[model samples]
Target chain A: MPKVEFNVDRCKGCELCAVFCPQKIIKLSEGINKLGYHPATVKEMEKCTGCAICARVCPDCVIKVYK
Target chain B: MKVVFERPRALSDVTTHYCPGCTHGIIHRLVAEVIDELGILERTIGVAPVGCAVLAYNYLECDWQQAAHGRAPAVATGIKRALPDRVVFTYQGDGDLASIGTAEIVHAANRGERITVIYVNNAIYGMTGGQMAPTTLEGQVTATSPRGRDIKQAGHPMRMAEMLATLPGVSYLARVAVNKPANIMKAKKAIKQAFMVQIDDLGFGMVEILSTCPTNWGLQPAKAMEWVDEKMIPYYPLGEFKVPGEVK
Candidate 1:
């Protein structure tokens, strides 16, 4: 299984990861981070393909993936 | 477990000040990744321009010098000439490079200044409230051009990559967009090649990246990227306009 980690504080909540995720497992959390934006989180880790598309699309470089 | 992706060591650890979904962060990461891969982090000197990426020095872990508005190429010239062994580059935006600092970039490229330039073109001036830029496409709506840019009055969109390719001094010139993962990968490769040209002492090199300004464009991050693909790519086709041996 692929593991995804997000540096919540670094996320600006642009949601590019969510938009680009091939698995569509990434989504914005209801709660805001220190910057007051709803940072992205993995909703269904089991479905994540670890393609790292989220990391590639994320402008903030806040996502990391391990396989 | 194998690491698929992580922050490059060439990037600083602090959070960036860019707006949410801003493509500047993506461009910054690509540059940092290239620096790390090339093993030139210690000797690389970046000249930050007077635009949204003015604080690029804060995000990039390398020696940096802040340049006057549109004068990054000039400052980079001086730095490269003085410290010939150092790898120098300039990070500039459309307003800074195409409008205010046009002469500086042209002269530097014409002189074969042996430096790399990362030009970010977002169509509008992001730092100055979305004013129409020289690279702004025809019929594009900006803060200053409420009714869209009029080609008769504003003239045509400036294609810097194609324009710069005409100069014999330039060794490499390419235009790439970060709208999608495949494009981002190609953009990174172009950036790396630009740096490599400078490293080999070929000549002036540049990679013009089509970026997005969602806040200024009044669109969501995803939509802004779509706009880039829909509107921008038609006018500015992405490809290597010039290469060392291919040109001339």
Candidate 2:
């Protein structure tokens, strides 16, 4: 199972993960979080391979991956 | 694939305490890999600074010292002078290097000290609640500069690499990032070059890594990398800032 979590407040809205996501399942949300940045969302969790690549490339650590 | 991503021998088995997406873990691995590859793990002495990486001594397997806030350069200077044959490097952060230790770094480079400095410039201070740092960009908001860094009030971001490259004593200076694997490779090369310069008895060498402090910069892990690419790169452009004795 691929599981991802984001600490919404920590996100700074850089969006590097969206560019690197192999499955392209992640996207920034339309609504702003407490940090005033659109945090990433895993719209299609089935496509995730649990590679944690998105988590790895993120600089903010807002993303957490669990398999 | 038996084990391509195993930890380096120079790194201890203790799991890193860095926050998720914190590139400090990756940077530590890179340093340990270089130390292992150079066959200097036994002779290398690393100096840890007072920022997020203050506990680096705990993770790195080689001999280590914990220096006061922004004093890693001075400590490394002493260690190198006392043991010229050993490899000495200081791992420091933006706050440690660009702020309180500015004079130390400047004098160390100016004196041409035979040491290597791994300067991690994440723009904001990671520890102590994400305060605005000297490297924080203009209009880049932080805990201190909530309205964004005001050039009129806070002055402009400091370009440590460009500033030190111009000093006569600095023999090698480069700025690399860890936003991606390709960039990580570049950072590794630069790090190796720094240590190789030290081994050759070359003068001062420093590699300023434009790292992402996702926790401090108020960005998600992925976005922090994006921020690095979109914002940080333009201000602190990467490349060899200074390299003396080149054939070219």
Cα RMSD, each candidate: 0.8, 6.2
DockQ of candidates 1 onward, in order? 0.88, 0.12
Off by over 4 Å in 1: none
**TM-scores of the candidates in the order shown:** 0.99, 0.81
In candidate 2 chain B, what residue range of length 10 has the lowest lDDT sum?
Answer: B1-10
Give the per-residue lDDT of model 1 (tens digit) for B78-116: 999999999999999999999999999999999999999
- Judged by DockQ cut-offs, the docking class of candidate 2 is incorrect
Quote the lDDT for B107 in model 2. Answer: 96
Sorted into a CAPRI-style docking class, model 1 comes out as: high
Cα lDDT of all candidates, in order? 0.94, 0.84
Q: Where is model 2 chain A poorest over a 10-residue stretch in terms of lDDT?
A: A55-64
What candidate 2 gets wrong by more than 4 Å, as runs, is A1-67, B246-248
